[model samples]
Target: MKPLVWIVALAVLSYSTISGMVGHDHHVLIIAGATDGYLSPCGCVKPMSGGLRRRVTAIKQLSVPNMTTVIETGGFVKDSGRQDQMKAEAIAETMKLVKVAAINYGLEEARLGAGMAASLDRLSGEALVATGLGGGAIPVKKFKVSGPFLIGGIDPRIEQIGAALGSKLEPIDESVRALTDEAKESKLVPVLMTRGDLESAEAIAKKHPSLRLIVCSVKSSPYDAPRRVGDTLIVTPGEHAKYVVRIEWDGQAFTAYRFFDLGPEYADDKQAQEVYTAYLARVTSEDLLSMVPRSETDVFAGSAACAPCHAAEQRVWKASAHSKALATLEKEGHDRDPDCTGCHVVGLRSVNGFRSRAITPNLTDVGCESCHGPSKLHAMNPTKHKLAKVGKESCMPCHNTEHSPTFDFDAYWAKIKH
Candidate 1:
C-alpha cells in the first residue's frame, strides 16, 4: 500500500510539470528608439555609449530562440537632408537585418515627407508603422507569437506641425480605437509605441485602457525602470540608442524587465561595421562637409597668435586634451565626419573655420579661438578688439548633457584655468 501511494504521487508531479511547460510560452520584447542617426559613438570621448554595431551585438545576445521580438519607438534622424536620407537607409538595413517586428515613425521621419518615408519603409522590409499621419505605413502590425501580438504607433507632434510639413493629419483617437478594436476581436495583446515621453503615453493609457503595454520615448534617462498604470506597462527605451530595454512576458503579464547599456562590453558586429563604413564613404563622396552651411563670422587667428600674448594659457591648452581633440577623431577614423568635426575643431560653422587638416591646419583641434570668439582682429589690434569674457557657457557648445554627461564646470575649469 505504501509503494502504490508513492507511485501515484510521482505520476501526479510529472503530469503537472509537463502541463506547465506546454501552457506557458515565455517571450522577450526588446525595445530600442531615438537613434537620431547615430550609427556609432565618436571614440573621441571616454565612456561613450551607443551605435548600431553595438546594438546588434546586444540583440544577438539578449534574443531567445523564437521568443524575441524587437521594436523601435522612432526618430531615425535629426533632420531631413541628403545625409539624413542616407542615414535612414543605413538604419533601415540594420533594423531589418535584426528582424525588428515594428518601427514607429517619429517627427524626423515625418519631416522626410510621405514619399521618402514610404521608400524607407520598403527598404526596411515594411517594418515601419505610423498612426494619425499615415501614408504607406500600416496602422497596426501583427506579430505571431504564442497568442498573437498587435502593435501600433502614434505621434502627437504630427498634427501640430502638419502645416509646416505639408502632411495630412488624421485623428489620433480614431487610430487608437481601431487598433484597440482589432486586437480585441482577434484576442491579441495590444501594444502602442509613442515618441512623446511619459505624460503623453499616460494620457493615452487613460483614454485607451485596452492597451496592455505602451513603449514610450522619454526626455529623462533611458535607464528609467518600467512603470505600471493600472494594467498598462510603460517602458522607455532611452534616447540616441544609448540603451535597449527588454521586457519578459509569460503569455500573460510582464514577468521581468532590464535595460541593456550599449557600452564597451559588447563586441561590434561585422555587418554593422560594414554599414557604418559605407555611410562614411558616402559622406566623403558627396563632399557633405564642404556643403555644410556656414555663416560669415569673425576670422580665427589660430592658437599660434594666442601663444605670443598668453604663453601660460597656450601651455595649459596644449597639456589638456583640447590640443589633441582632432587626433582623437583621427584615431577613430571619423576625422572627415562633419557631425563630429564641429565639436573637435575650431569654428566649424564659420567660413574661416576648419575645413580639412590640409586646408586649416592651425584650426585642426579645439583652438583658443574656439571659445574666445575668434580673436583674429584681437590678435591684430588688442586695443580695438577687446575679447569677450568667457564663462561656463563657453564650454556648453561641446560639453552639453549628450556629449559630456559627467561634465562639472568648476572641476573641468580647474584643469585649464588660465
Candidate 2:
C-alpha cells in the first residue's frame, strides 16, 4: 500500500512540473504582408477593404502594449518602377511608425536593387530581414519580449533575380538550416517569413521542423486557422493588405489565432492618412498623370458628340454614375491622381485621351467612346465607320473583382440601358 501511494504521488508531481514549465507569458504578434502596391482602397468602390491607414488602425487596436510585436512578410509592391519605389518608401515609413520588428525582403524588394533596398531598410527603422539574400537586410532579427525570438526571411525565387540582388544568393534549404541551428544553439524560438504559396512554405516547414512559426503570403483568401505541418504552425497575413493575422503566444505555443479583415470596421488611422496624403501630393506634384505611357488611339469623340444622334443613349449615360465618375474623384481630392483618373475619365490611357478638365473638357468622365471604342471617324462617316458592339467584357477593364466585387452585368446594364 505504501509503494502504490508513493507511485501516485510521483505521477502527480511530474504532471504539475510539466504544467509549470509551459509558462503563460502572453504576447501578441501582428503580421501584414503581400501588400502588392495597394497602399489604399482605390475609392472607385465603396466600403472597400485594405489601405495603409486601416492597417495602422487595426494594428493599434489589436496590439497588446509592450507584448505586441509587428512584422511584415514583404511583397510590398506588385511591380518595379519610380512609383513602386515611392510606394515601398511610404510603406517603410508607415511600418516604422508602428515599430515593426522585422520585414521579409521578398522578390519585389530584390528587384528594387541594393540601393533602394538599403534605403527602405533605413526607412523601416532597420527592420528588414533577409536570410538567403543581401542588401541592408539582416539574416536574422531577434526579439526579446518573452525571451529571444529569432525571425528570418527567404525569397524562394532568389536565383531569378540574383544579379539584380547584387549579392551571392544562398540556397533556401541552407538558409533555413542556419536559422534553425542558430535558434537551437541560442535557445530561441524560430520564425520564418516567406513569399509564395502555402505549399512551398509547408515543404520548408517539413524539412525544418525546428521552425516554430512560418508567416507566408498565401496569395489568395486568408486562412481562418493556422495549418500545422509537423509541430510547426503555418500562417498567412493574406494578400494585398486586405487582412492581417494575429497570434497570441503563451511561451510554449499559440493560444489564440485569427485573421482580421481590414474592413470598414477598422477606421483609418490619422497618421497613416497623413502618410497617404503626402504620397498623393507627390503623385500630383510630379504630374505622374502625364507621364503614363499612352497607347495611340484613332479618336475619342467625347460623350457630347454622341448626343446628336443618340440622345436617349446619352440621357441613360448621364443618369448613370459613369458620367459623374470624375466628380467622385473631385470630391475625394484625387481628381489629378493618375491611378484613379485612368478609370474615372476617358482616353487617359491613349495619346488622344483626357489630359485635364482645362485641356480636354470634352473627354472628362467615362465618355461615350470609353465602352463603344474611340469614334471620331465613326461620327463623321456614320455608315462607313460603324461602331463596334459593346458587351459585358467592355466593363471588365474597370469592374474587376478588386474594384467592383458586387458587379453584376445584368443588374448594372439594366440601370444604364438605353
> Whose lDDT is greatest here?
2
For 1-418, candidate 2 gives per-residue lDDT tens digits of: 6743543454345324433333348677778978899998887577677889889887877666677789899898877887788889999888888899889887788787778877888988888887776433433332222334677888888777577665567899998898898788888788888886789999998999989999877767577679999889999988888887877678788756766667676688998888888888887788778899999889888888888999989889988999999989988778888668888899898999999989998889888888888999998889999988889999999899878888999999898888
Instruction: Report model 1's TM-score to 2 decimal places.
Output: 0.83
Residue-pair clashes, model 2: 1
* Model 2 lDDT at residue 413: 89
Q: lDDT for each of the candidates?
A: 0.78, 0.80
Model 1, position 252: C-alpha lDDT score: 80
The top-ranked prediction according to TM-score is 2
